[model samples]
Target: MKELSLYLMSLLYITAGVNHFVMPKVYLRIMPPYVPFHKTMVFLSGIAEVLLGVGLLFTLTREWAAWGIILLLIVIFPANVEQLKNKKARGKLPLWVVILRLPLQLVLIWWAWLYT
Candidate 1:
């Protein structure tokens, strides 16, 4: 189950990385206006995600990958917060669902830590 979770996470990161490159424009739009060099950040983030995915593929680097993902999740949290705030203002996503997702990050981090 641990291996399965790691593989699934790796697959998800790889796919998300590919999407960053393939559909950068879409990603760019979501980036916070305060972020500078949007395209470069997107590209770099994509590369980092790909590398993290690769890191997860080996047991030797499993812990590193877990830490990396946790850090990444933390780094992106502000964006999620902003999105949730905006959604609330606009009455977009159901408040319950958005609030629910906030705790899910912790679960994902815990899951990553478990296999490390």
Candidate 2:
């Protein structure tokens, strides 16, 4: 179970990281207004995600990578809040979906903690 979870988490982060570059505009839209250099931040975060995800694949780095992912999730949470707040303005994504996402973040955090 531990190994399976690690693999899934790694895949999750890697896929998300790839998406940041493949669909940068989607991430850009969800970023809070106060944030600066949206494009650069998006790209850097993508890199971080990929690197951390790769790190997870190694036994030696798995703990550190898990912690990195947890920190990354916390750091980016405000964007999720901002996205939820402006879901209507951003697009027609359902209110329930946004509402559910908040809890999902906590679940992701807990899942990351397991590796620590």
Candidate 3:
């Protein structure tokens, strides 16, 4: 069960990371206004997610990758918050979905911690 979950988590991050690139404008929209270099941050975060997701596949890097994921989730949290606060960022996404994302971030962080 643990191994299966690990794989799923890796895939989720990998897909999400790829989405950042495939849909750069989507990510750019949610970036907190205060954060500088919006485009650079979006790409760098995508790279980090892909690297960390791959890292989780190996025993030697799993722990570090898990930690990195936790940190990454924390670092990107403001974007989620921005989405909730700024209607334009949320686009046509439902109010409930945007509101739910804040708590979902905590759940994601906790899930990553399990691997650590």
Total clashing residue pairs per candidate? 0, 0, 0
- Top-TM-score candidate index: 3
Q: Per-residue lDDT for 1-116 in model 3, tens only? A: 99999999999999889988999999999999899999999999999999999899999999999999999999999999999999999999999999989999999999999989
Q: What TM-score, over all chains together, does every model reach? A: 0.80, 0.94, 0.98
TM-score of candidate 3 on Cα atoms, chains taken together: 0.98
Q: For each candidate in the order shown, give its overall lDDT on alpha carbons.
A: 0.77, 0.90, 0.95
What is the TM-score of candidate 1?
A: 0.80
* Model 3 segments more than 4 A misplaced: none
Better structure of 1 and 3 per lDDT: 3
- In candidate 1, where is summed lDDT lowest over 10 consecutive residues? 83-92
* Top lDDT hit: 3
Comparing candidate 1 with candidate 3, which one achieves the higher TM-score? 3
- Tens-digit lDDT track for model 1 on 1-116? 76687789999888988889998875665566687898998898888888888889987987898789888878766656655667433244677876787888898788767756
Candidate 2, residue 55: lDDT: 92
Among all windows of ten consecutive residues in candidate 2, which has the lowest summed lDDT? 87-96
Between candidates 1 and 2, the TM-score winner: 2
Model 3 misses residue 95 by how many Å? 0.7
